[model samples]
Target: MSIKGAIKGLLATLASGCLAAAVGGIVVYAHGFSALASLRDGPLPPVQQTRLFADLAAALDGLGVILALLIVLVAGGSMAWVFLAGRFIAGPLAALRQALGDHAASLGVHLPREEAEDPWTPEGLGTTLRGLLELVASREADLVASEAHLAAVIDAIPVGILAVESTGYIRSDNLAARLLFGQTDPLVGKNLSALIAPPVHPGIPGRGKDTALDMVTRAAQTHETLAVHCWRDPSLFPADVTARTVSRGGSLTTVVTVHETTERRRAEAERAHHRALVSAALEASTDGFLVVDLDGVVISWNRRYYDLLGLDSDVVPRLPQAQRYERVRAVMADPDAFHALYDRLVNDPATTVVETMHLAGGRRLDVFTGPFRVDGVVAGRLWTERDITERERVQADMARAKEEAENALAELKETQAHLVEAEKMASLGQLVAGIAHEINTPIGIAVTAASHIADEARELAVAVKANLLRRSTFESFLETVHDSATVLLSNVRRAAELIQSFKQVAVDQTSDERRLFDLATYTQEVLLSLGPSLRKAPQRVEVDIPPDLMLDSYPGAMARVLANLVLNALMHAFPGLPAAGTRDDTPDAPREAVGFPGCLYLSARSLDDERVEMRVADNGVGMTAEVRRRAFDPFFTTRRGQGGSGLGLHIVYNLVTRTLGGRIEIDSAPGQGTCFVLTLPRRAPEVPVAAPSQCDASGTLGGDSTV
Candidate 1:
C-alpha cells in the first residue's frame, strides 16, 4: 500500500475507536451506573422491576466494562499504529524528496519523473526516483567524459581552433590558435581583435573597416568563411577562418577554425620568379632555339627561331609542331631534303644530326639537331640554327690569296737567279778586257824590236858577199844586234808574265778551287791586272798587306773582290771634268800637283788566331744613311738608270760569307768616305759556291760600295 493509504486507514480506526468509547461513557452516565453520576429519580419500567431486573443489571455492568476496555484498547492500538506508520512513511518520503531535489539541482532538471503512472505510492515514488537518480549519474559521467574527449580532440588538431562569442570575446581557443597569434597567456575571455588583425570587409561599401569580432559575427550570421591576416610579432601568417553559429538555451556562440597559408603563398611566388627568369633567358639567346614535346606540341621558342623559319610572331609558340614544320618546309629551297632531315631527327634520337641549308637568296645556314632530355631519357628534339654564309666567303678568299702568293714567289726566285748569273759573267768579261789590254802593250814592243834586229842582219849579209870584212862594220852590226836582242827579250818576258798571272786569276775565279797562297802577292797581281782601268782615274792604290799572311781559301773569289773594289773606287771617286780649254802659259807646279792629287784607296790585312781581317777604304763621296741601310739588297740601287746593276756589294757579301765562310761589315757617312771590312777564315768550305748572274761591265765601274 501507498504511505498515504496506510495513513488514511490508521486515521479511520482511531476515529471509530474514539466514537465507541464516547458512546459507552454516555451510556454509563445516563443509566446512573457510574459513581460520578447521580442516580436519576426516574422510575423503572414494569418488566425491568421484576425479578430479572437484578440479573439484567449484573449482565449490563459486566458487558459495559468489557466494552469500555475494548474501546480503550482499540484507541490506544490505533494511536500506536498511526505513530509508527507515520514515522516510517514520513522518513522515506522526506529522504526521497531531498535526494530528488539534490539530483534535479545538479542535472538542471525538475524533480520526480513526470512520466510515472503512480508517483504517490511509496514503492512507485522510490522506484521512479532511484531510476532517475541512477540515469542522471550515468549521463553526468558520460557528459564529463565526452567534454574531456572533445577538449582533447580540439587541442590535438593541427589547425588553429577558436570558439568565440557574439560579444567579441573568445570563449575558448586551442594551443595552435594561441601559437598562431603568438600568445603565451590563456586566450579564453580575451578580445579577438587584440590577438589578430581586424578583418577586412572588401564587399561592404562605405564601411571600409571592421574589427575581427564584428567580421566574425557577420560571418556566423551569414554562414560564410572569412580570410584574415594575423601577425605573431615579427612573423605574419594568412589564415582562412570559418565561423559557425551554435544555438543552446536560447543563446548563440561562434566556433571559428583557422588554417595558415604562408608556405603556399611563398611557393606560388617562387614559381612566378622562375617563370620570369626562363622568359628572360629565352629572349637573350643569340642562336635560334626551338623546343617541342614528344607529341609534337610546341612548348617554347624564341624570336630568333621565328626569324630563321621566316615565321610570323603570332604563329610561334602557339602552333602544333607538325604544322610549324610543314610551314618551314614549304619555304625551304629543297623541300624534300628538309622533310628527310626532319624525319631522321625525330625517328633517330641516338645520333645528333646536322645539315647545311642553302636558301633562295644565296644564304647558308648551319642547323644542328639533338635530343632534349629530362633526367636520363630523351623527351623531345632541340633545333639550333646559325648563319655561315660570310664565314665561307672569307675562307675562300684566303685560299685564293695563298695560291697567288705562291706563284709570285716562284717567279721572283727565277729572276733572282738570272741576275746573279749576269753579274758573274760581266765580272769575267771585265777581267778579260783588262788583261788583253795589258798584254797588247808588251806584245807590240817586242814585235817592233824584232823587226829592227832583222833589218840589221840583212845589211850585214850584203857587205859580207862583197868581201869588205872590216872591224868598224862588224862592230856596228854587233852593237845593233845586241841592243835589239836585249829589247826583244825584255818585252817577250813581260807579255809571258802577264799571261801567266791572268791565267791563274781567271782559273781560280771560274773553278772555285781552294789553294794556299800568299795574300800580299795575290793583291799585287790583281792590281797589275786592273792597271789599265786604274790609269784613267786620278787615284793612288796603297797596299798595307802582311807578306807572310797566307790563307788556304778560294783565291778566285778573293781576286774578284779586290778587283771590283779597286775599279769601283777609281771609277766613282774622281768626277769626270772637262780638260781646260787652254793650258796656263805660266803654270805653277805646286798648283798643278795639288789639283791633280785625287782620291786615295787603301787595302790592308791582319791575322788574328785562325781568321784574317781585310779592309778596303777609299776617300771618295760617301753615302747617306738611307743608302747604307739596304746596302746588301740583291737588286736595290740608287743609280738604276745610270749603269748600276746593284749587285756589286751583294756578290761580294755572298762570296765572303757563303763561299769563304766569313762575315763583312761596312761603315760610311756623308762627306766622310766609306769602308768595307771583311772577316774571313783561313780555310774555305769544301762545297762549291753557286755562281751568280752575269753583270754589265759599266755597272761594276764607279759603283757605290754601299750596294
Candidate 2:
C-alpha cells in the first residue's frame, strides 16, 4: 500500500481505541459514585463508612492511573508508528518528488512548488507521481528523437563534420568527413591530427609553433573558424574549418565543419592569369592607352601614355583626376579645349569621340575615346592616342607634287601636238615634191610635141604659098602634124591624172571627214599616193583587197593609217636598203638591205557586215619580241639616230583605234617578218575625236589631225 493509505488506516485505529477508553472510564466513575452514596444512607457504622470511602478513593485513583497509563501507551504507540512511517515512507516519497522535479527541469519541463507541498490523498498522490513519471518518459523519448534527427541532418550535409574532444580525438564524424580523408572505416576515436594538417593562422602570434591538437583546442576555447589546408592523400587542398564547444552531460565537445575550396582557388588563378595577359598586351602597344573609371578616377595607363603626354611618373600617381588633367592640359596647345572635351565625354558616356590634338612640341596626335563595359555595364572609358605628325607632312608634300606633275603633263601634250603637225606637213611636202617631179616629165613631152607640130604646120604653109608644092609633100606634112598633136594630147592627160590623185590623197590625209566608200578603191587610192615612196623601196608591193568591201568611216584617218604603215615598212623592214627615194647616206637609211628579197603585202576584207580586217605585212627583217610588244608606243624608236621619229606607227595606231574606231595588233618575231593587223568597224563611232595626247588621241571632221 502507498504511504498515504497506510497512514490513513493507522489514524482510524487510534481513533477507535480512544473512544473505547473514554467509554470504559465514564462507566467506572458512575458505578463508584453510586456505591459511596448507598453506604452513606444505610445503617452502617462511621468507621466502616470512612473505610469504604478510602477504599473507593483508592480504587478511583488506581482506575485514574490505569486510564492515564492507557492514554500514554496509546499516544506513544501512535508516535512510534508515525515516526516509523516518516522515516521509511515519507522520506522516500519526498526524495522521489525532489528527484522528479530535477529530472523534469533537465527535460525542459518545470513543476510548481505549490503542487509539491499540497495535501494529497493516497490516490491523488499516486496519480500525481504517475503523471510526473509519464511526462519524464515522454521528454526522454523526445530527446532521443531530436538527437537522432540532429545526427541525420549532420550526415546529410555535403561538407565534412566532426564531433571532437579537446584531447584531439574524433568522437564522431559524418560520411563526408570520412570521404574527405579517403577512408571507409569509422573515424571515431581517431586522432584528428593524423587525418589532416593543422590550420595555420599567419597573423596570429606564435602560429608556427602551434600543432594540430593545439589549434583545435584553441578553436574550442575561442570558438573561431580557421581557414587551413587539408591533406587529400598526395596533395594539400584549401579548406575552412570552424570549431565550436558544446556541453553534453557535463562534458565539453567541439563540433568542427570543413569546406573544401579547390574549385574556388582554380577560378581565382584563372582570373589572375587573364589579368596578367591583358596587362602585358597593353604595355607592349605603341599607341597611348588610358582607362578611367566612371568617377573620373584614373584606373590604369600604359607607359606610352606617359611618354605621349610628357607626364611626371612620380607626381601623377598621387594626383587626383582634376590635378592630373591640369598637368596634362599644361602640355597641350589648347588647354581649355582639352578640358572642355574631357567634360563633354564624361557627361555623355555613350558617345564615341575621335579628334585631333596638337601638342606643345608641334606634334599632332589622333585621339579616340570610347566607353568600355564590364559585365554589360558601362564601367569606364578607354582613350587611345596615336602620333600622326609625320603622316600629315607626307600628305602635304604629295599634294604639291601632284599639282606640279599635272602642269608638266599639260605642257608636254601641247608640245607633242606641235611635233605631230610638223611630221604631217613634212610628209605632205615630200608627196608634193614627188608629184611635181612626176608631172614635169609629161608636161615637157607635151611641150616638145607641140613644138614639132608647129614646125610641120609652118613648112606646109610655105609649100602652099610658093605654088610649086606637090601633093605627096603636102600629105607628108599633114601626117607629121597629126602624129605630133596626138602625142601632145596623151602627155597632157597623163599630167592632169597625177595632179588629181595628189589633190585627193592630200585632202584625206589632213582631215577627218566621214564618207561611205569602197574599201578596195580607197586602199588603191592610198597606195597610188604613196607610189613615189614605194617605187624606191627594195620590197615588192602586193595588194589583195576585195573591191566589194565598203566602209562608212573617217577616210582621212584611214588614209593616214595606210600611208604610215607603208612608210614604216620602207624605213625599218629591209636592212641596208635606202628609204623611199632617199640616198643610202641619208639620215633615214636601212641597215644592210642586200641579201634577202623583200615583199610588202597590203590586204583588206569584210570580216562581217559591221566590221572589216586589214593587214600590212612585210617579208623583210622582222621585229624582235621586245620591239613588237612596244611597237605602237609613242617615242619608242629602234633607229634612234638613223632619223626614225618612232611616231609613224604610234600615229597609225591612234588614228585607226581612236579616230576610226578600230583595234590594232602586231604579229612579229626576229627573222620571221612583221604584220600589223587592223580590225575596224564599217561605221565608225559618232563621238567627237580629240587631238592627239601622249597616250590617247582622237580626230573630228574639219578639226586638228590626231597623229
Runs with alpha carbons beyond 4 Å of true place in candidate 2: 1-97, 109-137, 151-229, 233-258, 313-318, 339-352, 370-380, 426-430, 437-444, 447-485, 571-595, 620-628, 644-649, 688-707
Candidate 1 residue 91 C-alpha distance from true site, Å: 19
Location of the lowest summed lDDT over 10 successive residues in candidate 2: 76-85
CA RMSD (A), model 1 = 21.5
Q: For model 1, how does the per-residue alpha-carbon lDDT over 1-707 read when each residue is reduced to its tens digit?
A: 33344334434433122111121122222222343132233333435333223433344444342111111112211211011112224444444345445545565644555455555443344355445545555665787899899988988998888888778788888988887788887689888777557645343222247777777777777877677776677755677777888886677888888888778768878989898888788777767887777777777777887776667856656876677777888778898898888787667775688889976557778888778789989888787887788889988998898888776755665666666566656767766877888888888988888898888777788888888768899999899888988988998998899889988887876767889999889988888777766676545566778788888998988987887666655555444533232332222221122232344444456666688888777655666787776666666676687777666676776677667787777777775667778888887677433543222332222221211
Best by TM-score: 2
Give residue 517's lDDT in candidate 2 (0 to 100): 79
TM-score of each: 0.54, 0.70
Question: Cα RMSDs of all predictions?
Answer: 21.5, 18.4
Q: Name the candidate that leads on lDDT.
A: 2
In model 2, the clashing pairs are 575-591, 575-592, 575-593, 576-591, 576-592, 576-593
